[model samples]
Target chain A: MNKYISIILLLTLLLLPLVIYEDNNSRYEKLSKSLLCPVCQGETLFDSPSEYADDMRSVLKEQIDNGMSDKQIMDYWTARFGERINTNPQNSNYFLILFPIIFGLVFGVLFYKKVSND
Target chain B: MISSIGIILTWFGFLNLILMCFSNKKNLFQTLVRINLFIHFLLFCLLEVGLFLDDFSLYYIANHSASSTPPMYKFASLWGSLDGSILLWNLVLSIYFYVYVKFYRATTELYDIKIFAMIILFFNGFTIFSSSPFSGCIQLASIGCQDFTLLPFQDLVLSEFGRGPNPLLQNHPLMAIHPPILYFGYIGLVLPFVIATSELFNRYKNENWIKIAEKATYFPWVFLTAGISLGAAWSYEVLGWGGYWAWDPVENVSFIPWLLATAFLHSSKTQIKEKTLINWNYVLACLMFLSVIFGTFITRSGVLISVHAFSNGNIGTYLLIGLLIFTFLFMYIGIKNIEYFKTSRKVENIFGRSGFFVANNIILSASALIVLIGTIYPIFYESFFSRQLTVGRSFYDILVGPLLLILLYLMVFSTKIAKVNMNLKKWIIENQNELNISLIISIFLTIYYRASYKFVLTIFGSVLLIIIIGKNVISKYKKTKLQGSYWTGQISHLGIGIFAIGLVLNVTQSFSNELIISTGDTVNFGEKEFIILSPYEEIKEEKNVINLPIKFNDKEKNASLNIFKNSSQQAISSPAVFRNIQSDTYITIKVIDDDKFKLIFRENYGIFILWLGLAISSSSFLTRVRK
Candidate 1:
């Protein structure tokens, strides 16, 4: 009984993503969070309560209603406000994110090898 | 006159520390340390009295406090700015030093005291010479005080009435306690580093230092957890943003030390039990201390753009130099005594308790490194590429999220493994029933809620972790009555599981909407209908508060804004929260006109669970300390 229940739960979890659909509201939230409020310090558009953020949110709503893709909407903001508008680093700076992971992997491997060898 | 006394005491304390570092006689050294501690305690008390008395002759009080400020806020005003905060830091450091000398002196050598004294002397010197709270306007004039108009010899009163504290600092009661608690945590980290570094320098081969260092780390680790949680609660309550934990530079820097210290705590356990990872524990202790200095630099130097950052000053350069000196010193000692702590024991099995500790260390260290990189990347990028960039929450969420998930997975399984060697298949077979039940509950909840993929995964992992911990705790309690360390460790891990669950639910299910409404206007969102009642104003001592009462469903709540009656006319918002076990209805009001107001209504789910988890996790330390 436990094995069957575990298998069923595992399968359901694996297939759960397929059943989840993205709506425009969630997309709008995602877009607003991905963009920073230019007027506020360290606040995203969704989080900032400034009048400028309100206007930007309205503009974002309009763009989403006009059926722009996520990339296109992102590009629209980045082109207007430079690359700093987007929260994620640029593609060229991907190495900055990978540096720590690679370092952790190397350290783990070396430590594990030493311990296992002894 | 009191300000002059404070200045004299600060100088005396500085000199005392310096003398204590050089004194070879143990009696003289102890005397000097006691005097140093006494002088700082006197200085802090003097500063607090000045604040409470509204002594405008003192420059810091005149700038930070007003006569009309409440007694609680007046007491808190000691750390309301940079200079006074440094005084608070020094005072806390003095207390820690006294406690160490009085209690743990038997385990420590004279050389350790000297090294620790040098550190104390540096900080004391920094406090006195660079950012003295005792300076009056006349002394401040030499440092380019823009508002100074008096002659050097004239009575250095700048204002008959003070300016009061920062509006944000005075806005919440939690501000009174958060900084002091956090300062204690930050300053307490130095002891472990001092112990470890001194041990390395002395070429001590015994494992007794590990016990002392681990004990030193536990209270600070608990305080850091509580401090960070209080800070998050303060942000959520006072910032009117309906969110906690923004992954800001200052916040990240605080968390970096915490993560490293937590890693040290876990690995130090392995070192004590199995005599492995001895060098790793020392490195972690040093890194934790260095990270605290780096965090202080990031917060005080104005190098980062954060709401929590202090004003830019020359102290940044001094702190950076201090950091470099300490880093070089630690690296030198670490290299010179690297072979002293080399372990000869082997882990015969990768699936055992030791491997789990190793994996835990790597995951936590990686998480800290990723956060550090995300935090300082923009600074490096701008300096090197001449381009401005913002590494925001998404950067951290993308990189550190998977690492945390892996950590949770390890926490779930690691407890079930044997100490030295374990048969993985037998362990799995033994825990199959519990595993399946956890999966079923998690999946059922996820399906019922229709959560996103990331949310689903987090919920699953958290549920599994909680179940494993709960089972282990029950079985262990029934078997032989759980040990102190084991009990505290399991409870803290259980708290993490609950915290993770609360975090995911709050992030994924929470929603906020803004509406423009006037008096007598009714707005509807979802099933709840909110009617704006008449707004009223109240005069509260130093400030005027405008409260907008709204009736949502069956309950009435007020979202108020405080307008301080100072020259600056600073306004702060106090959001109204209708809270329950499952969710909170948070409302913040912004007055556009006499009758018009813009309000943001946020429904935050599982916030109570988050606080509950923090309470459990932090309180476990108290139990262990008692034991």
Candidate 2:
């Protein structure tokens, strides 16, 4: 009985995070945070205090009101400011995207081979 | 006169270091080394006295001090600028080397000590030649000399009082301790770098190096963690923004070294336990040391403009040359002895403790590598393309955030993996009750907060971790004795769990907005009514300060946010915070005119928990250094 309970709870815990609902306000915030603050060195638009950042925020609001998707808004900024405008790297930067995958595979293979020989 | 004496002592120490390099008498060598270190320490003390006495005749003091500056801030000005900071760095390095030699000179080889001494001597030379703070002013006759004929000192005249330290530095008391603690952490790298380099150079055929390296790395790791936390705390307080970390180049540089050192600590532990990944440990140690140099270069070079970086100068080129020299030296040695890192120990179970450590290192190293590329790529891009690019928090969060989650999961999963051969049913039954209780509590909290499942999961994980570790601690104590290493490791893990929960709460629950209000106007903010009392302005010594009195809904106590315009014509905001057990109402005021003021109110929740966890984690590592 304890084993069955544990298994069910564990499964539910694993799947819990996938089920949370996100609202539009939170979505807007996340989008704003994903873009860089142009005037600041490393700050996001959501956190910057410059008047330019405030203008960007209003533009973001208008785009959202116009029914643009998150990706489309991101595209709009990227087109104007180049790839550096968005804080998130492009999908084309595969070296960064695939680093963990490549490193894990190579490390795992080496470990396995070393252990087998031992 | 004191400044000249300090410089003379430094020169004498350098000479002693050179003589000791060839000296054959062990006791004499030790004596000379001690004198060299003692003289360097004395020089720093004299410099500090100059700051305290408000002796503007010293070139450094004349430049960085003010008659009106408070006594506490006067001492902090010792490291408030470039040359003084270098002097602080020199003092820390000399003190650390002295302590290391005192403790390990008898057991360790003399050759290694000589090499380390050479490095210290090089630092001594650099500081004296390029960045000396002990420069006497001939006009006023301060320190050691009455004339400006000395090599390092020059004739200079100034007004009755000196200019104060940078306003940002003197604004908070945290500045007094932050730079010194960070310098200690940075200088602590000398031990591992020297030990690892010598080990690779001579191919030392003993296991004692592992113990020595681990022992030496422990204090620095704790200090580095503490320094980073203190820096973040300073930012949270001083920087008008609500966030702590901005993924700025300087912040990333500091964080990168900490990550690599953390990886080295884990990998070195694996080498101690299973005799595997020894070479990887060596590689990590060298990389961590190099990262410190790289971080220093980034801050000093002025290649990247950041709030935290020192002003730009030729110091960048010197640091770059130093970094390149050490990089090639370590690489050459690493290449020569790469074969020694390979281990024959085979893991029978992939889910065991050793495997978990391997996974931890991979994630840590990857994260560090990603940040390194992100930080350095911009410099290269600008040089080649004559354009600028930025890698900000958004880039890092997307890449490193998921990796951190995985690391957190492993932190819990590792507890179960140790006894992989145990019966699965028995294991589940043993832990099931506590797990269920934690889960139920998490569910309650999640429902009450109406938070996402991700947040709930974090709570569940944290609760589970605390309970399991608590049980282990109790059981271990109940048994006749407890393992110190196990106790410390578990406590640190518990700290990580707590920190993660705080981070989650901070991310999901924090609220911030701006409100413009006039006198007698009431504004609703975050479930509280803020009633503006009145606006007033006062002029301090060098600035104009504006104060806004505000009262919370039905609360007797009032809070005020102060805004000041300084000599630099820059407006600085000092926020007022209303504290509670679980949250705080932080307000920053910007004065527009006589009546209108803009107030930015940010509610920070669970940050204390994060700070509490940080204290716990750093103290736990400190325990590892003890007998």
Candidate 3:
């Protein structure tokens, strides 16, 4: 029985992410949070209360209804306001993303070897 | 006249620090250090008096304070700006140095004391020469001031009143304590670094230095935890964002030191037990100190775009130079003393307590490293490629999130592991009942909440940790009396568990909506009805407030907008929250016209648990401090 319960739990965990889908409202929230406010320093559109942010939200809603993909919308903003508009670094900067992973892996291996050898 | 006296006292304090660095006589060194501390205390008091007296002769006070400011904010205005914040930093550093000299100096090597004094002297000199809070407009101009005009003394008097503190700062009381507590945490880190460096320079026979370093780390670690949490609380209350952390550059910089120091604390524990990771602890200590300076530089330099950044100044260049010098110095000393710590032992079992600590250190250090890189990568990218970018909340949420989950999972089993034995299979068998119960409950919660896989895993880890810790505490109490350290450690871990659960629930369940409504209008939002009452405006002191009363499901709350009557003309929205144990209903108003208003309503679940967890975790540290 315990083994059966464990298998069921494992299956549930694996299937959960696939079942979770973002609706339009959540998509709007996520997209707004991922974009920086053009007029505010270091604040996202979701957090900024300026008129500019309000206008941006309207534009975002229009784009979402126009069925623009998340990447396309991000690209549109990036092209309009340069790369700084998006809060996340662009996919072109793969080196920036990989640096932390490599750091963690190398450090983890060295630590494991040093500890296990003795 | 008061400004000149303050400057003279600062210079005198600097000179005294210089003399103490070179003094061979212990008595003279102690006396000089104490006098330096006294001078800084006096200087701080003078700044306070100037703020209260509305002394326009002092440029900092004239710029950051006003006659209309409250008494608490008047005191907070000391650290409200760039120059004055550095002065506060110097004062806190002086107090730390004096405490070290009076209590811990006899056991510490003279070289260590001198090195520490020299560091303090450098900062003292930086304040006096580069960023003196006592300087007038002319003196400030002489040091390359660009943010403000260099007005004559008569022009300052013509203004008649100073500009008050930043509107956001004066909006909340947390501003008064957060910076000072964070400064104490930042300055407290210098001692461990000094101790580690001294140990590296002179090979100590006993491991007493490790104990000293560990004990010294506790209060600072506690303070940093409380400070960071309080900062998040301040953001939640004052920023009107309905969220606590935004992964902003300033917030990330402060968090990096806390993460590194936490890593050091964990590793230091294993070092005390197994006499291993000595070199690693030394490196971690040095890195913590470096990160503090780097954080300060990032916060004050304006190299990155942050709402919390000071204006761009020459101080950034000086700080970068200081960072480079110390990096090279620590490298040289670390390499020179590499052979001294070669006799340390290795972990006998990978599943033992020490081994788990190693895992903890690696995970924490990696988290810190990732945060550090993410924070500064934009600057490096911009300078090198001339392309502007930002590393925001998504980056950290993606990279560091799994590491934290893994750390939490490790916490469950690591607590169950015995000191010297490995029997992992046997241990699992013994705790199978607790494990099964935790798994069942987490699965049920996951299904009920319809949470995603990441949150489901987080829930499992948190539940398992709490159950195991609870079981352990119960069994331990049944067997024998638990020690204070043991209880505190378990309580802190339990706090982490609760905090993790609260964070997951908050992220997954929170919802917000915006609506435009007029006074006496009713609105319905997602099964909840809101009745808007009359809107009123009032003037208090220097602020013009517009208050909108609303009844949400039988609870009356007021959401207001405050406009400060000052030169900046800043307007802040004050959010009204209907607090409960389960969730908070928050509302904030933005005036569109005389009749219509835009209100943002946010419902955040389990936020109080986050605060409670933070309080329990941080307050537990108070009892863990060693004499």
Candidate 4:
């Protein structure tokens, strides 16, 4: 009886995301507002309220509606605007270099604790 | 009378302070130090009134004072302007210094005392000489204060009406008091700092300095907490900006010191275990002082533009230079003197109080660092890369969200998990009944808060807060309630918990509507309705402003709003109000119509929680004071 209950709960949890799938267009449309245009100094693509921003938003909407994923759209933007257009720093290079060091320092402490305890 | 006396007393104190510092003979110098403090108090009283009184003979009075200013503002106006404010800041420090001496008269810590005096002198000299409030007024002719060009003395007010303080200040009660309290709190950080620096040169034998500075430290800690909260309260009341802190550069200046002070207080517990986070503690103390200098520079220099009139004059560049040199010197000293504290103390457990404290410091510092960067990032970007940028909610909300989640988790678990040299489950088992009750209630509250967030991550935050409190509530129950320091820490952390809950509610649920409406018109907002009535008006004899009242009808509900304007002008600025709500419905009346009709409506998710948090946090201080 417990196994049945636990499995049922697990299945429900696993299936929740599928049921909650947001429209692709809506998700990307919201995300694009926070991203900056590479050519602009400080203005976000969604912020300009200009012809270019309007055009960009429309293009994004079309692509998203066609079922392109968030990552794919992001990749497309990176190619069009170069990596500079991205609001967050790319998860490569400096961030990549720092990530493992941070992981190591954190894990190193735990690793040392485990070894010492044993 | 007060004007001259303030100067004479300050200099006399300065002379003795110098004597105390240079003359190493312990007996002779200590006497001089005592006299220095006495004179400093007199100076404080003298300048305090000059700013407080409507005495036109005093230049500070002529500038910052107006007879129309209310009594509380009269006290508050003492630190209203640049020179007068520095005087207020230094005087507060002098009082702290004096209080420290009185409290520990029996202790013979000579080097620390001398170093403290030297630091006080430096602060005093900066206030008195460079940008002295005691320094007489400039611009007698300019801006028509005295009509500097022709017969300046004759033009000056003998009892003539002068311009009152900024309207924003006089409008709120918190503004009148919060700044000065914050200033004192900021200045108070210097004492522990100077003592810590002195400790580097001496043997670590004197644990008493921390004890001596304990109450003095808590005194400021309480005030700083009050000051910051009051600042938020003031904003919530007046600034129409619903949020208390905007991550504004100005706000960040005060927050940086607060973070450091909190860290210092937490880590100072290391003294109990024969081990210390000496380097960390020293850095915190020094960093706090650095934060004070940075705030002083930022406010005085007008690097960031705001309504604070204190940020007037050439003080900015000098303050910036002072900040760079001072920070460098302090950091250099800290790094160089690190060898003096080479006692390698192992952190006992990952879940212990000290461990939790270390984590707390990291989170706090990280928050402060982000704020610091975002605050000054624009300037650095402009100077270095010639790229100008504006950091807004996008920068703060997203960046801080993850950290806040982490902090909430830590905060909840910390109290539960961080037992200092005590048996945990054994303690809990004894008080399990109350512990379980508090735990259940906290969990319920967290769930409610998470539901209010409208996001999944809020669940995590809520759980964190519960863990933090549940652990501590159990511990506090086990211990005697009369334990002063122990109780204070627990109560304060409880205040923090309540405050976090409030912050979560406030941000998630606060609802506002911005729209235009004329009088006698009805507008619909969600299921609620607002009937716009007429504008309310009043004029005070002593002031140059007309106050208009707006009648608000929120879904057949009646409310009133007061819109203020400069008397000389036909055009007016934003509206002000004393707001009230029924059943979480926000009813506000703003003037949006040309016939000056009232715009009124109800908003969802009231910020009552914010107020609750502030009240709870501030209550701890009274408890602290009483105990």
Candidate 5:
């Protein structure tokens, strides 16, 4: 039964993108047209047929088909490039940066107390 | 000469600020700040005009300028680069510097204000000299480095038209307003730093600084929220994702500061309630400022390449130093004044909303920090290990999702929990009255969409939020609408709830397709179908595009997708939908394969609520004028 469920899950995952692939592409197309290409300053990937975006699109299409998930793809890229390929960088690695954050809060609280007391 | 003048003006700003600090003269700081402001304005005009006039002799202009780039874009290009953006930032800073000084001139707090101005001036001056937006571009040929500078005007190498703006930015009008609004929010944060320092120096500690800072903070926080919302709005309309906020790097940059500001707001509430939180308030202010620096770093450094980032040459070292020195100065001042943190307040109401508000700030910061780490880890990786790693949507969703749900839960219950000034027993009894039955009904109404199998989990999340909002609204209406802050909070929270619902719906129910279908072509999707009747073409001075109207027949209703340009041009979906009722749909058709065309269907609801949230949150500023 577990094996059957696993196969079913895999199939379902595969089918999900098939159903939504068109939607994803339209979304990409719309977004590509609207946002500036980060790699190429002035042109949109939608407007300019650059090889870089073309490669990214192909990779995106493959990921959609593989249904490997965003984490898997991100992990793969992290492995391939280290940590900078992420469109959104998370602040986990240098968590110590928050030391300043903590200090700021402490100071803010102190300032509030003294002001309110007066 | 202009650069020298700018340096002199910066020194003048510093000088006036210094005089204000030591002088016992009445309103000395105010007078000095005003003088400094005039000097800075003249300097800014002197510097920017060089670029605005396309004086290629100036390295700043040459690097950013191109022959084919239009005059209008040239003007916009002033802020299109990092050094320039920072320059404009100081210009805005000077405006606020004088205005704040002038407004508070008669007030007893002068030394604190002077310190704040001095700190800002030092940081500004250091960055100007180091990063120097006017720094002449290095000759790549001479240096033997490949030419990488984005020349603004250039002869079309392949076509008559210049490569259009990031397809994302050029795709919509919202792009124009979105960044500036975010900038306003970012800059507004500097004022809180000044006020916090002012309070510490005054030794006249009271709710006054919190009260003043709360108003100052809320205006920008509100603008920041609106700015974020409009970006999402632009995304939904222009990106064809049927959703806003892609969890992209640029979006994350806007979001992080917003989260810190939110924490600052909630912490202020704690201060107002128990007149304490000495350590915590400083932390929140510093976090907000840090977020501003971090967000700017992410955008300008050209380190994190994403659709939302603008490409100026590498500015990592410049950004890091600026962030470091500013933070260090604030830390020194705050720690030096540790005498002010003697009294600690008792947690009178852990079961109450005030406690919950503190928890909310914690959650907000934690989530923002997680995003911050994921966003910048690659930079560290590249700098140290010579490796580049990238984190994306799934990482954030998994990490922050549970915490956010808890936040949502707190938001739901906060309206019911009374504290401090409220008569809790009587308030509860009144809330329990017959009027609450309507709330129960509305809560059920909020759930209706989620109960449907066709709907997603976010629908229920939205419903839960709406229900909580319903309870709060019903309770508030029972009381008078006289308190502006209370009403403002009400509208703001309600708008947030509505926006939450809209966000969930947009993310879940949106539809997209990319294909090749032309005029008179028909494509069927799920329950909806699109028929392309005709194609229309439009040519402007800068843009050339085709417009097509497609008719949609779905479970919702018959709608049309207005799409133009696919292979040769950018795709634009002109969704003709207008209403605040929560669920609205727009359809656009893009011709990809001639007969096999792409169709995009999207639904955006609750944006009107987002705007309403802006209205209510911004109203907190009105309290400044309150008698």
Candidate 6:
């Protein structure tokens, strides 16, 4: 039971970074930079000066000032611009994040078992 | 006229390769292929001449060249765009084909050579049809265009120059060699795959085939290692972002193949020990080549957005078709030869050398899978949902980071494991003294430096690991004549350790911030002082280039950084780095106006160790070829 709880706790801690809210300017800048600017050829929101990027920036600042959380702001944009605005796949496509770890562990065990059986 | 010769030669080369594939006169066909390779080389020479002559009649030269451009840049411009870049790729591929035929033809299977010849023909056909540098110029009136003016084409023969290479391409000298070296690595991958697949077709049991494949793997592996290092170096120097890798799609695509190839190398070793991994070897070989093709498709597809990806159309579909055909064909072979994969002998110990390789491959393949999924997710999202969902760096970091840590753990401990059973307690008991000493040292250093507890743990682990491996290597070197492969593996593992240490230090201990400063302002960033001397502006053609001279950490030498406002009126910051053995002080300036500028100051502690590690690892591949 303790082992299971520890595993659960570790997983929650890993997911914490995804859920944590940013209240500072640097974090905001980093977040904005990761978001793609749809109007530009190949540029992030922070790097582009396209009208859409400018509008998105305005929205970001507006939400931040209004005490809106990061997820709230992200979802707001997702709703407005469709899933295209969600730069990184989030809650809906979390399996992509989990697949590698699970595969690694499974393969590690199978390989270890095969090697150990003399 | 000269450019047309390149096309004619390329067509003839393709014809010769086809003939070589079909004909019974093998020696005659091989000689013809060699001669055709010469023609390919000559064709590239003519193309270079056309570029140098500023021949506007050649469409590629007119678009990518200028009379006023420096001689070095004009030559480098050969790969600045799509058509010319394709031509360069073909040149490198032909060169590799020539070398392979001339040297390895005697020992290598004929089927391998024939298949390779066919691959060469396919690439030749693609180059000719999709991106032909020989196509006539859009503006033929300005033939022999040359000039000293900014807009020289307006004045015809007196002043008829083309636009210079892209500002981004011309910014660094590394641009000239980086692409070609990378292409060499990418195209060199074709040989091993063709050989491995040919084995499936012939069912030939030649012992020399594996040796041939190993040779093919090592040389290209060296080039790929060098190419990746050069790319990271280029990014560190050129991209003002102050980061070497961003987990960008294009970066991920290139990395996937390298990972697969790494796995292939290990599995190939497994085949030597047990011969069980033969089928896995073929699969990996196919995947490595397919991943290269996938990388090519991604870069040219325009399906995903990346700063470094090429802008092209229809080529992606053609490449996708080629990929599908090859993948299905390889799949068919794999299924037919399914029984060959099973081994009669079982692994005696889980902690043996072969066992270590199995674990290593597991991590490698998993990591490759992670990268592949992360890279392809956006494409899938876009295709299925008609939504542009980007897989951010955080996703990759979360997915790949722990796996790398596991890999590092396995790497450090594998040496010990190779000599023991799966008894962790016994292993720890034997090495406890050295481990404790290293652990204490790491703890003290971490505390002294005010690093995080996690960092302390990582440092402790790496130090303990390194000490154990280093001690073993030193003792081995003293006892016996050092085996080339053994030493190379040790060096490469050491490189991995060093790189991990650098990455940990840079990520956890670095300090960075942006400040808007004016002349004579001394800004304190972390522990270092940056003094902005003065800002000056100069007009280079249509762009206003702003220069900032900075005194870093009270150093006597001042480095001047250039910032330019391009035609789009966006300020582009070019960072100047003061590289030292221990650390690097990086600074980038963005022009706010004449007197004021936005300065990004970053001090990365021990980041040089990362490059040092990469260099050490890359050079180790050379040792394999030494004898």
User: Considering every candidate listed, which one attains the maximal DockQ?
Assistant: 3
Residue B239 accuracy (lDDT) in model 6: 56
Candidate 6 chain B: worst-modelled 10 consecutive residues by lDDT:
B147-156
Tens digits of per-residue lDDT for model 3, A5-105: 76676676667657763322467888988899988878998888677888898899899999999999999999999988888773666787789999989
Q: What TM-score does each model's chain B reach against the true chain B?
A: 0.94, 0.91, 0.94, 0.83, 0.78, 0.91
Q: How close is candidate 1 to the true structure, as a TM-score?
A: 0.94
Better of 3 and 5 by lDDT: 3
Alpha-carbon lDDT of model 1: 0.79
TM-score of model 4 (CA atoms): 0.75
Which 10-residue window in model 4 chain B sums to the lowest lDDT?
B147-156
Question: How far out, in Å, is residue B333 in model 5?
Answer: 3.2
The true-structure Cα RMSD of candidate 1 reads: 2.9
What pairs collide in candidate 3? Answer: none
Better of 3 and 5 by DockQ: 3
Interface RMSD for candidates 1 onward, in order: 2.7, 3.6, 2.5, 9.3, 12.6, 8.1
**Residue by residue across A1-118, what tens digits does model 4's lDDT show?**
5335434543543344344533222365355644664443244554332335546766887887899987888788877776545554423324422443354356435533432223
lDDT of 6 at B626: 43
Tens-place lDDT digits, model 1, residues B18-41? 777777786676777778788888
Residue-level lDDT of model 2, residues B398-497, one tens digit each, is 6777788778877776665553543445555777898787877776666555677557767887888877877776877766244466666777888888
Estimate, for each residue in B1-627, the C-alpha lDDT of model 6 and write its tens digit.
555566676677777777867776646756866776786777677778987887766666776776655677788888888767777877777777777776655444477667776777777777667666665544433433232221212322222666556666666688888888888887788867776777766664554444567667777777887887788788777756467777778778889888888887777776665665565677788888889988888877787777687755678888898788778878887777666555424555546667677777888888888888778877886787776777766677677777777777777666566434556666666776666567556655564456654455456667767788678778887664445766667777777777777877776666656577888998887677777787666765524556677887656332334333222324445677877876788887633545676666677776788888788778777556545
Clashing pairs in 2: B1-B142, B1-B143, B1-B144, B2-B143, B2-B144
lDDT of 4 by residue, B1-627 (tens): 444455666667777778777776867755665576667666666765665566655555665667766777777776677766766666676677776666643345576677677766776766555555454433443211442111122333343544555555566577667887777777888767666656554555565555544455676777788888888767655543334665656777888888778767776766444355656666677788878888778656765543342565667776676668667756666776666556535565544566566676666766666666656655664577664444555566655566667765565545544444334555445445444444444445434433422223443345345455556556566565434665566566666665565565555544444346656666676555545555545565434333333333522333333232322311223234324431144443333345653332334243565566556655555545443
Candidate no. 2 TM-score: 0.88
Q: Each prediction's DockQ?
A: 0.51, 0.32, 0.53, 0.07, 0.12, 0.25
Backbone clashes under 3 angstroms, per model: 0, 5, 0, 11, 75, 0
Quantify all predictions' global Cα lDDT against the true fold: 0.79, 0.71, 0.79, 0.57, 0.56, 0.68
Encode model 1's per-residue lDDT on A1-111: one tens digit a residue: 866777877888867856862322368878888899888778888877666787898899899999999989988998999887888764446786678668768877787
Q: Candidate 1: list runs displaced more than 4 Å.
A: A20-25, A62-69, A90-93, B106-108, B139-155, B343-346, B418-420, B478-483, B567-570, B590-594
